[model samples]
Target chain A: MANGTVALEEKSFYEESTNKYSGILSWLLTTDHKRIGLLYLVTICAFFIVGVILGILMRLELIAPGPTIMEAQTYNTLFTLHGVIMIFLFIIPGLPAIFGNFFLPLQIGAKDVAFPRLNLLSWYIYVIGAILVLISLFLPGGPIDTGWTFYIPYSVRSTTNVSLAIFAAFVLGFSSILTGLNFITTVHRMRAPGMGWFRMPLFIWSIYSTAWIQIIATPVIGITILLVIMERAFGVGIFDPALGGDPILYQHLFWIYSHPAVYIMVLPAMGVVSEIIPTFARRTIFGYKAIAFSSLAIAFVGYLVWAHHMFTSGISDTARWIFSLLTFIVALPSGVKVFNWVATMYKGSIDPKPPFLWVMSFIVLFSIGGLTGLVLGSLATDIHLHDTYFVVAHFHYVMFGGTGTIFFGALFYWFPKMFGKMYSIKWANISVALFFIAFNMLYFPKFIMGYMGMPRRYFDYLPEFTNLQVISTVGSWLMGITMIIIFANLIYSVKKGKKSPENPWGGVTLEWHTASPPPLENFHEIPTVTHEPYDFSQLEEMKHESK
Target chain B: MNEDKQNKENHEHITPYSTYVLVWLALIALTSITVTVSGIDFGMVALAIAMLIAAVKSSLVINIFMHIKFDEPIFKVFLMVSLFTLVIIFVLTFFDLVNR
Candidate 1:
């Protein structure tokens, strides 16, 4: 129970590693989890920026309807790259790869992940996969215009570098698998003595559930993408209708993995929300077991509902009904999580920090996303909304509004701990406000346009869709400015901000027990756990100590 | 070092070498039986038989070769959950195709 002990003599993780290699090589070749997490951080941020730019370009093209900024082919490629970079590189790996890698072991009172070298290898594989994607962009036939899904027949027939891009995704899938393996092993074997499964932080539970999906569901995408690459390269005839392969079969295979991949992206974000809520509310989490078990329940039910994405793909009525039923079922667990979070904050001394604000926005935005998902999950309504901008809006509400907001919140929550400096809270809150407003403005119109039958992935829209499109584009510009402000505030704070103490927000987790910007090995002496995670008495004790 | 020793003690389970041999033989026997059954025109039943044999073989590999039998109950539970998920996916997907 060594909570809030100072190890002033110990060097921070940034200062050195056990490895003899110094400077950049220490980062590049090190097996340290914190360093590797930072590696993932820098890499995903670069990709996220690239994705945002591609997205803005697509929005610009759509702003005025016909051929505003780029030609039809360029627009197609831009959207394709935008989806690939965002889904595969940024959002899929966003929270888990960065924050989970850095914080999981720290929170569990372990020195590093179970397979530290394997952790480093996953980052390397991630870079290699990312490089392959970039290389495909400049290849002979031009970047793949096949959307990130790489739906069959078109993917088979496209002369572009679909094979390379698909292969890039395949490599990325392997990286995902290894990371999942590392996390699962770490969680199973690396918890501190006396830290039973229930005693562990809810964040660990969410990450564990996500890891299960990653290992079990990701291989389906790996094999599916390889089949596409094979079909493109050698006419394997697996998905090509002309070649006796069923296109719907391809849809089945893709969603089998891709749908679960959605949970992979959002489940960890939900875990972040759980962590932030209890800390800010200054109370033990409400329904801790319910929230923890709901994560697994989501992962379980999530796998069964991938076919909901195929409702318009001419799937059987039985399949559609069953999947639609499962889709609604999946929503129950998510609803449980949301309700539990709200209950946790009930009548508590809520610290209205930037991170908590983001969590509040997450509850609103993700609820909108989740509720509209029910709209799309219903077979009757999905037929009308399939492939429309409504679908696009629903997705962004969930992915960007839900996961993206939480990612920023987690960064805000942990920034002081990770960097030993506090960012400007005023600027942080201002950026979050602008971001939330601009985000809704940007994507909310899509719900209207989509319901009005505005088809997505189209280069031109009828004049009726013009005004809403314009509003969305203006929102994108605001988003761009917001991004600039947010990143600049964080970047500037790293070098010049006030130094953070060991427990900045009075967090009760094991991570708060150690130094901010913890040592390379994460702890001076591995702590033995005695209390349940989010136990408020620890926070009360720390507060008294400060006085 | 003490933690490492404790972890090793927790996870290291040594199965009898003869058990692996027996599981390997069973897997091979199952595979050959499946191959021989494919010659008969039992139609859909033949496919079911083949799958049944494959399932048994996999369980043997998982439980014995993978040491889930001797290792931890949690490992076996997760293994079952993973397989159950695969089954649900297949059954649900076919529900659409068959009904349509």
Candidate 2:
């Protein structure tokens, strides 16, 4: 406990990491990874709120058989904006930018990322891209109505602000690529001594794998978006079908980046679950190598399954079947991870805290998402269900249920470490309960509606679909309420919550070895790792020593 | 621990200027071969030959210019993995094109 007192004497990264600036300027200009993480945290939350409001509006507009609030064109623009903001601005960069930036160094026992300056520049580029998206919304031609995918000929021929929006996506891809490059370099060059590959935390493993996908796959989308912009602006004949370009080729390039980009979103969430489950279970992970290798497996296999998205898009039967097989194969690694997580929790000394509840929710929701993914991955069913609400329900269950829930779970899990304060466990649980119930209510109906042959992206629904649309709209309100409660609780807790201990969760990672909120240099002295990550004996020893 | 220290040590192997010139010449020669072979279009085989020559040229540039050959094995491993990913995308796309 003497080191705890000494750590208290050490200035936290929040207090002052640099003397050149003060207050807002200090945070704005800071190269400190933790501060930059806070910067991302604030920015993404703002974008998330915008996305949520847009989503709620879309749901409200769909509340009846006819248009409820807006015209079809307005509805189209709203969904496009909602999709663009949510996918590109919020979820894609959500975990890796916020938590990865803050904790990758701390978890690996390093002073800072290998390229701190590039890390800051990536954030700036993200903001610039966001600004361009904002500018596109208000230009002479309202917002883009081409959907977030900006699919071909329609995208090239659209009169809306498609050019700027695609360009925004291109710039955002650069931000993603740079962050991925930085993490890859940091992991490769900067692990603490004795922290062998296997000894590193599973969170590090997941982020490393996600980073590789970000680096390799993002460039394809970047170029694809650029080509779309060119086709729009300069009349380039690349992806425009009218100009003798193949529209399916655009789908190929788009999904090539985007399908793996799904892994980019969810893999880090998996990483978060990996960290949370072991900590809550108070045990070594059931199969460390299996879980770690599965991340690599998922990443490797994820790249091969992009064309599964195009099964019903007039792609050849051979490509369709091959991609369908690869899609199912990719699920095997995810299955491995899911099984390993369940096994890790079996017969262990379980602590069902707020974070653990979220992990449990993630397991259920992501399982539904992953299992239903097979139905859509199959060539026959996809032809039946493509562009239906079934596909919508599937991804929302996976992306929102898997990644979005874990994003909050990680926020709760790492709250104390990041902010040096403890949020109310009661409020946290209430929020999770509302979220779980409301989330299922919101998206589960889509599966049924989709099976009943209700098409997605429709401004108006048939009278038969009216009841489910109303239910889904009601669910959106509950989701909005849940968001309000969660954000208000955390923001209030930041100033008024109880002061947390250095290691609140009995977490055995190197991040827990540092001060809550961590110092400017992270470690007082870099601790040499002799035990494997998730070693419970060391955690117990540290607990006893602290006591 | 010793291996850790050894990995940390900056083993900067500087390539000679002559090596860069020779690699550049080889790249130019490969480019000319691709261009010349394109003129003589051996049906479908021409595309295959051009791609093969382009791959070899890129490997040389990556190995010597990017220092993949002089660097640790892990770099080469990652490079191969990335190339393999590209191969997967191309093969899958071609599956559709060829079949259709």
Candidate 3:
């Protein structure tokens, strides 16, 4: 009943006498899901920094003319490493495994995710995968140049560390599958007594949907990457075009997982936005069932649209048409989500807060990204746009604009609860502003240059594209500087910011019912949910009369 | 949280597991028969019969193993969504191949 009042309560979990140890041991050997989430926060930040630095370097190399700093081969290795690190390492596991793992069980009024040890195991597996990839970077033959796609024949013929790279991907895919399996079981088995399926938060719904994509799709990538490794190492002919194997089969296998893997990345970000928008708007989410079902719908339809990525790969015209149509179908659910979010904010007392602002920006940027995606989905348009900077800009607009923007939004929304301290929101706002401008400036020219026949993954380009590339390079540095400022603000907050209460944002979710940086065991007693999440009116009535 | 409602519901009797077993077994037997018939090369007749048997088998599996037949309508909706995805993927892929 006290939980219905929307106030933070200090409990045994936050007691000074508890075994919540200080320093490295607390982080390394902790079983607390919050601590583990923090560990992920730390690890992913490091990986993100590495990935961002790679991006800056790549942009710099492309700045002046013909390879300013590194040679073309080295540039190839840089972007390949960048793509592999950012996609497989950072974005795929971005929102769900880290934040969803930390927050979902708490949000659903459960003590922990269904399998806690397996949750910890996922982190270890992820680290091992990261280590293997880094090792591949140093291996003989100067890292793989076959791009992250690792298309066969090129992968088979290339004199790079293909086995090491693909094997690392295989390990990471296993980690992804295990995380997905754990999330599915937890959602099914671990909800509290009165917490029905419909009562669950939109964030949890997003994770639930993403979990299915992971369980069903990751294995195909695993098998595909394994066959590539076999072809490279053991001389198995599954993907080897030279050895009676169809290279296109390799593309089918890779995109089957990889395309939906994009959904896996963005769906959770959408979940993050759903949570942010309602809390900030001070209202119940508009059409909760529609938004929740849309997440699942996106995940379902997302699987069929992968072949659209292959349309320009010389697949049959019929395949192209089918994939094109399916691609349009896939956009419908995402459209539903965008519409629902706007409707949720329509008449509500809107909070111009950081998270809300980021969500709004996400809508604008992701719309551009999503609409361009439809352009690429059209068979005729994609033929011209395929493998160009148009595709590059389109993807980054969705990915960076979609997932990357939400990553910052979630950091601001939940940073207090996660760290038990509030970040400097002024700095946070500045970071968002600078990031938005720089991000667009960096990627927007890509569309223009791409249309002008500038191909992606090339170290050198014609003189015609020089001015646009120069402007984009400047934007990349601004983005880099903004990221550094963000890191500084985060560190400053951790060391010395206002100690936060549990319900800092006044959110109407079970997570807000618990302590900031919740306990070793999340709840003192298991909760029985009564109200739906985002019942902000009830929360308001309770808060005002009680005060 | 109310446990009393759940206890009262549990007191009411339902169909026995033996009935489910019989249904499952019968479905499996029909599946084998259809597979055998298909081997006889009855042209489109064999293919149609085999597919019909497969559908019956899947229904039985969902009804018994997955227990959707006894479930609330929402569960049917969820199951339908999953089945729908399978249909979309297979149909589109089939159309792509056949048309090509």
Candidate 4:
């Protein structure tokens, strides 16, 4: 592959694109999208582990009612930190900040995102925001214990350093906005010669939709967080009821962004599934236009359902029912996606790789999560299950079970391509199995106990709920072990795994046309698409070229 | 390719100084209208009138000063999508508040 001169393919991205810096400075200051992606991957994974440990500690406290592992105040702080780190530090940036940065340009046949400098700036802003959140923990006011929602009256009055933490979130919102702007520009201006809108990969479509949500919805949260910071730092009557600010209005503002923000978390996961299902099934994706358009539909409908979270929070009956109807309406596009994925797999050659297995699990678990969400979306059922463990279980099944699984699913599918090495497939399979079982055990019992009237965010429970609590605690332990094994398998592979063959899975996306751990600029020559995305007839040609 | 065509359409616009001056004058006049309406106290409609004038002023800046007029049609579509999202949020929130 190497000629007399330095071609982009002669050196892998790891050894190329230094941007004139060397050593640690090369990484910290590098504007290479791939390197910056790895930067986000490492940081986000660290926050994920921190969030997981906080969760395990919280579960330990609930193992036996009444001061089992810590004080009630300590329990309050733990759950708050868990939600904060998981949602903001981990999942919000989980897929887009990492894989989207790495693969979006590659899939679109662009050398890099439209604004490479702005892309790197997004990562730096993310790091600065993360640091601010961490610094707030040790500050004099104490850790933010208002839960991730930072619901006001309490958020405004809490003695903890809520202002700094909310300020951190405000800064993170900037990173989200800038990243979104970069992707939109990239999609609009940098698509390859023959890559039409319909010819592009579904992952690009989903992330494109997610970028719009990030641009449109994130600023709302940015403004809401600033208001909380101001009301706390000074006596601004914005959110505090005592100061004549409406607490309900705060709920309205918070959910307006945070609800659509959930789509920001899941839309890309859905896109990843759309990519993987067809590759494993060896078929063109069914209803390509339908899947693509549904992404936009989901984003548009997701905005109207924000008030569903505020259904029980003193919102008017008209708003509650209308939002409830819209919440149910949002399920239509998700159903379209799930249907298309399963249909694409029908009567096609299917390979049950770890990535495939993870998504298969995602289909079942996320369905349960989305369907159970309807129980909450119903105005009456929500009033009953509003703050209970049922609510807790519902989101976890969707979020942790949904996006969280696909996050790793994508990592496994693209791991070899990203690192030029393959993970231990046997161990990867075992880890996914353990994860599925452990995850169900941890959250499933919450539904039963919650129906029996157990509320969330509490350290103690009735003696009758003790059995399920113990099961949940043990499940958390199992989940902790499974995570460690998955990391061991992946971390070891990053350094010592066997070399992966090009087009290892015979994928047909634009990214697969190039070398594994592709060169700094991604391709030896830019590809001009002539067939639709996921046309499996191209697989044989890719296999021939790779060899 | 479509992207190339779009690129060709971009970075080629040259707005005359006269256009900028006209847009700026229109903005200033709209601002005075906003202030004038606020003083008249048209009750609840006062805020709506001010917002309407502000919207007109912004369209002048967007179309002329910002050069959206010279850009491809796709950019105008993008602007509309963003504004549509904002309008939906406001209308939906007002539904709750007005009913309450």
| lDDT to native, each model | 0.90, 0.91, 0.83, 0.90
Candidate 4 interface RMSD value: 0.7
The runs of at least 3 residues in candidate 2 whose Cα sits more than 4 Å from the true structure, single-residue gaps closed, are A1-6, A544-547, B1-9, B16-42
For candidate 4, write residues A1-547 as lDDT tens digits: 1111123246888887657877888888888788889999999999999999999999999998789879988888899999988999899999999999999988998888988989989999999999999999999989988888998888877899899988999999999999999999999888887888998899999999999999999999999988887887787887776788788888988998999999999999999999999999999999999999999999889998999888878888888888999999999999999999989999999999999999999998999999999999999888899999999999999999999999999999999889989999999999999999999999999998888889999988889999999999999999999999999999999999999976688788888887778888887777777778898887766655655
The model with the greatest DockQ is 2
Query: Model 2 clash pairs?
Result: none
Which segments of model 4 are wrong by more than 4 Å? A1-9, B1-11, B16-40
TM-score of each candidate structure, all chains considered together: 0.95, 0.95, 0.87, 0.96
lDDT of 3: 0.83
- Encode model 3's per-residue lDDT on B26-83: one tens digit a residue: 9878967976786796876876777788898888888777767766566687567667
| Candidate 4, residue A217: lDDT | 93
Return whichever of 3 and 4 wins on TM-score: 4
lDDT of 3 at A316: 74
Decide which is better by TM-score, 1 or 4.
Answer: 4
Model 1 lDDT tens row, A1-547: 3453556777899997859999999899999999999999999999999999998888888888678878999988998999999999999988989999999999899999999999999999999999999999997999999888898878888899998998999999988999999999999989988789999899899999999999999999988988887887788787777778889999999999999999999999999999999999998999999999999999888888888888878888778778889899999999999999999999889999999999999999999999999999988899899999999999999999999999999999999999999999999999999999999999999999999999999999999988999999999999999999989999999989999887888788888877779998888778878788988887666555434
Q: What would the per-residue lDDT of candidate 2 be over residues A1-547, giving only the tens digit for each residue? A: 1122224577899987654888998887889999999999999999999999999999999999786899999999999999999999999999999999999998888889999989999999999999999999999987999988898878877899898888999999999999999999999989888888999899999999999999999999988988887787788788766778889999999999999999999999999999999999998898999999999999888889998888888989888888899888999999999999999999989999999999999999999999999999988788889999999999999999999999999999999999999999999999999999999999999999998899989999889998998889999999999999999999998999999998888898888877887889888876677788888777666766445
Report RMSD (Å) for each prediction in the order shown: 2.4, 2.3, 4.8, 2.7
What interface RMSD, in Å and to 1 decimal, does model 2 have? 0.7
Please identify model 1 stretches exceeding 4 Å from their true place.
A1-4, A543-547, B1-40
lDDT of 3 by residue, A207-249 (tens): 9999989988888899888787778778877866667777777
Which structure among the candidates has the greatest lDDT? 2
List per-model TM-scores for chain B.
Answer: 0.82, 0.86, 0.74, 0.84
